[model samples]
Target: MDRDARLRKAVLWLKKKDPKLKRIIERVGPCTLTMMGRPYPVLLRAVISQQLSNKAAATMMDRVKEYYGNGKNFPDAKTLAGLSVVKLRKAGLSVAKSETLRRIANAYLDGSISDRKLSKLQDQEVLDLLCGIKGIGPWTAEMVLMFSLDRWDHFSLNDLILRKGIQRNYGIDENSKKEILEFTAGFSPYRTIVCWYLWRDHAAGI
Candidate 1:
């Protein structure tokens, strides 16, 4: 099926899974999630976005593009790997992040982590491969699965904002991690859509 049809189907499945999610869907309306499609750029953006606000990440990425991308396209792995750590740091990356970026570049160049290979792997396999890279963890891997690979079932259980959104929507003081996962399990293959609404509700202060 097409993208819009798939999203609509996901929405319907979510609405059936939980009435709370149904309300959230009514409140939030359509999904606004966008996929960037390229593994290298998407993973690079995810790295830059760590612990930073969206605007800050955008600014930093623009600087990176300007410095290494000839002020136009995103730099390829070979180009980024060739740049000095000092130059990468000047583009607003922390030393660790600079190192991580170079490592990611090297991984891409060495055939350890390519878009083609990742696309053929299952979600858990992909996570294991990505998390093996220094500085990439479960959350980052899930972000790549959802936003880069467009996997519809991925959910970020470690996200504090998602937990808070769940608590607020369910009128609970606290929920165990297991409970949250169990509750969300009802959504199954459409859990990504559920996460989108939860994030939307959190952002809207609902």
Candidate 2:
């Protein structure tokens, strides 16, 4: 139940579930993936990163943070909610993303989305709650679950990098959603670890 124990358990489970993943684990060595920052800031970053490269997203986020608050401190929900849409746009957000950021900030201010509340919800429940917000879809919800909530069982089947990693590593041709889900089911309760490895594989150009 400690961090190291949980990571070890995940690796062992993943190695037992799939040979390809076992090889990946051997190559990757350890699970160092972790969540960073508070939920509000993480969610804000997620919103800003939508449909943009990581560098672009980070640059915009830095500007947005500096415009609203000191760059070292992420703006709280109340602060973000009070900002004008025009001001958010000046930070390089698209109109839609700016609106989404406002909605997320409002949700936090209204107690609709909170770390305490989300911590008590199941993965699917968290997804349902978050996806109900405007401009937050399944992928975004899953990102929150994995990166903000630190839910070990979460996976993003719609992620292109994950799909490519699976296909390339497992030596399969194009796979359907059903196939991917079924295949990944073997990694149940530790699919987040699986995703991390898949992402690493993609990043390594494997």
Candidate 3:
């Protein structure tokens, strides 16, 4: 099946498995979740987004891209890896985030990580590989797995928005991680897709 077909199949499977999710799918329309880019740039953007608001992250990314890519293209791993932390800091990145981006670019350049290599690895292996990087944790790795690797089963439990969405939609206490895990497990293998709908539902105030 194609990517859209796979997403449709996952949606149908989730709808049949859970009534809540079925309603969520109906209201949310379609799963718009998709891989945004290759592993290096995807992870690069993820690092830049950490601990910041979406608007802030996007603005900073524009600044960084303008500085390095003349405001058009996102720089490649070599270009990013060659940039000093000071230059990146000047481009609106914190010193720590600048260092992380450089390390990620270096990881891609040095063959420590790559799209081809990551595609061959399982979810846990990918998590292990990425989380070994100094600034990346499970949340960032999970985002890479979901968006970059297109691993539909992975969910970022650490995401506050997702947790709040579960609370509001499922009536599960946001503080009760185990209950949320159990409730979400019913959507297994498509939890990420279901979570996409849940996010939409929360955003819609339904």
Task: Give the root-mean-square deviation of each candidate in angstroms.
Answer: 1.5, 1.4, 1.5
Clashing residue pairs in candidate 1, if any?
A: none
Q: Once superposed on the true structure, which residue ranges of model 1 sit more than 4 Å away at CA?
A: 171-175
Pick the lDDT winner: 1
Q: After superposition, how far is residue 191 of candidate 1 from its true place, in Å?
A: 0.8
- TM-score to native of every candidate shown: 0.94, 0.94, 0.93
User: How far does residue 24 in candidate 3 sit from its true spot (Å)?
Assistant: 1.4
TM-score head-to-head 2 vs 3, winner? 2
lDDT of 1 by residue, 1-206 (tens): 98988888888878877887888999989887789767778889888889899899999999999989978666899999998889999999999889989999999999999999988899899999999999997787888888888888877887778888878878543347888888777778877877888888878877
Lowest summed lDDT across 10 adjacent residues in model 3 is found at 194-203
C-alpha positional error of residue 154 in candidate 3 after TM-score superposition, expressed in Å: 1.4
Number of clashing residue pairs in every model?
0, 0, 0
By summed lDDT, the worst window of 10 consecutive residues in model 2 runs over 169-178
User: Compared with the true structure, what per-residue lDDT tens digits does model 3 show for residues 1-206?
Assistant: 89889888888888888787788789889888978877777787888899998899999999888999768666888998999999999879998999999888899889999989998999999999999999997888888888888888866787888988888777888888888888788778888887677777877887
Q: Which stretches of candidate 2 lie over 4 Å from their true place?
A: 171-175
Q: Flag clash pairs in model 3.
A: none
In terms of lDDT, model 1 sits at: 0.85
Better of 1 and 3 by TM-score: 1
